[model samples]
Target: MQACANWIDGGPQPSRADQWLDVTNPATGAVIARVPLSTAEEVEQAVQSAERAFADWGCWPPVERARVMFRFQQVLRDHFDELARLIVEDNGKTLAEAKGSVQRGIEVVEFAAGIPSLGMGDVLKDIAPGVDCEMIRQPLGVVAGFTPFNFPVMVPLWMIPIALACGNTFVLKPSERAPLAGLRIAELFAECGAPPGTWNVLHGTARVAEQLMADPRIQAVSVVGSSPIA
Candidate 1:
């Protein structure tokens, strides 16, 4: 079976833990691959990596960041079908559903590509006689996201692109059961010139979530999962 590893720092790296979780193809009930169940320390490392990257990424000019996002959007569009197929193989969703789901993800990236404008703050001109009031939007450092298995591409795309576009480095912990899609997304981000440590994917079980929630380095945690898991 293929061993799915964590996307740490800037590249694909195997989890330190020997314990593995089986990734099944829901359509065939077959064990297609195995993903490492990362430990708390591994999660911490991922967070630290994000934190380390935050200053540079967060300080990048909005247009530069948007350019990278624009490239990412094009790359996503070019390989949209292959990504949807991976989602289908991993999540066992219908090809049409997978395509639609991945398209929604690409849409979010498209939205993120406009962050230069979308993330702009309003200005109150000449407030109080020569004094101006401005509403400024800032990027939180080292944000984290926990995604579900069902709509892996769509949900995470909703979180990551916007977060990275807003200048926050991201640490994503995708569901172990359908992780290949997320890993591939990380690879594409790098291929499209996204900086390492800016988008990291850590695969694991509940411990990963606990660590994310407890970590000070993770400024925010966004999740898309069932209430039972929430």
Candidate 2:
């Protein structure tokens, strides 16, 4: 059994906790690894970095933003096997299901590159003489996403890249149970020219989620969890 890790700031680091949780291979019922239980403090650092990044990235040109998304789409497609293996190892899903989720995540990146159009605007009416009125869609600033274990790849796809494409920096609070898939997506973002602070991933339990939603710097949150979803 290896240690399931937490990635913070930019790279992997040891959990400060002496108390670690056993991550069993759900399919085999064997103790596959130990994942560090992250502290609330770590979560805050990741959020602060993302907020700082939002100041500049929010104003980045949409076409340039799309370029990053395009690079991510290619990287994920090329590394599909590694992604699927990690998903199956953590979540106990069948190989096919894992592959499907990766594919969908790729599609979301594709969607993001194209959704630049969402930011486009049309000048409706020209006022009298030289005066005119115009409107354009802009970024929503720093956004937060809380993803779930059931669909690790797909749920994050529904959140992170879209927020990035929309020109917002983000703090992604992925599920502790199956967080590696989310981490893999973060790597893709880094590869695609997403500046480190532009997209952040924090590993923890519910407290990590609360900190993100409660923070005044965060502009919005999209969470997917709970069976009935109240």
Measured by lDDT, the strongest candidate is: 1
Pairs in clash, predicted candidate 1: none
Candidate 2: minimum summed lDDT over ten consecutive residues — where?
4-13
The alpha-carbon deviation from the true structure for residue 140 of candidate 1, after best TM-score superposition, in angstroms, is 0.7
Off by over 4 Å in 1: 227-230
Per-model C-alpha RMSD: 1.4, 2.5
lDDT of 2 by residue, 85-202 (tens): 8888878889999999889888988988986686788785757788778987888888888888878788888888888988888877777777777877786677677666787777
Error of 2 at 88 (Å): 1.0
Q: For candidate 1, lDDT tens digit of each residue in 31-114?
A: 989999887788878888888888789999888999999999899999999999999999999999999998999999988989
**TM-score of each model, paired residue for residue:** 0.95, 0.89
Per-residue lDDT of 227 in model 1: 44
Q: The CA-based lDDT of model 1 is what?
A: 0.88
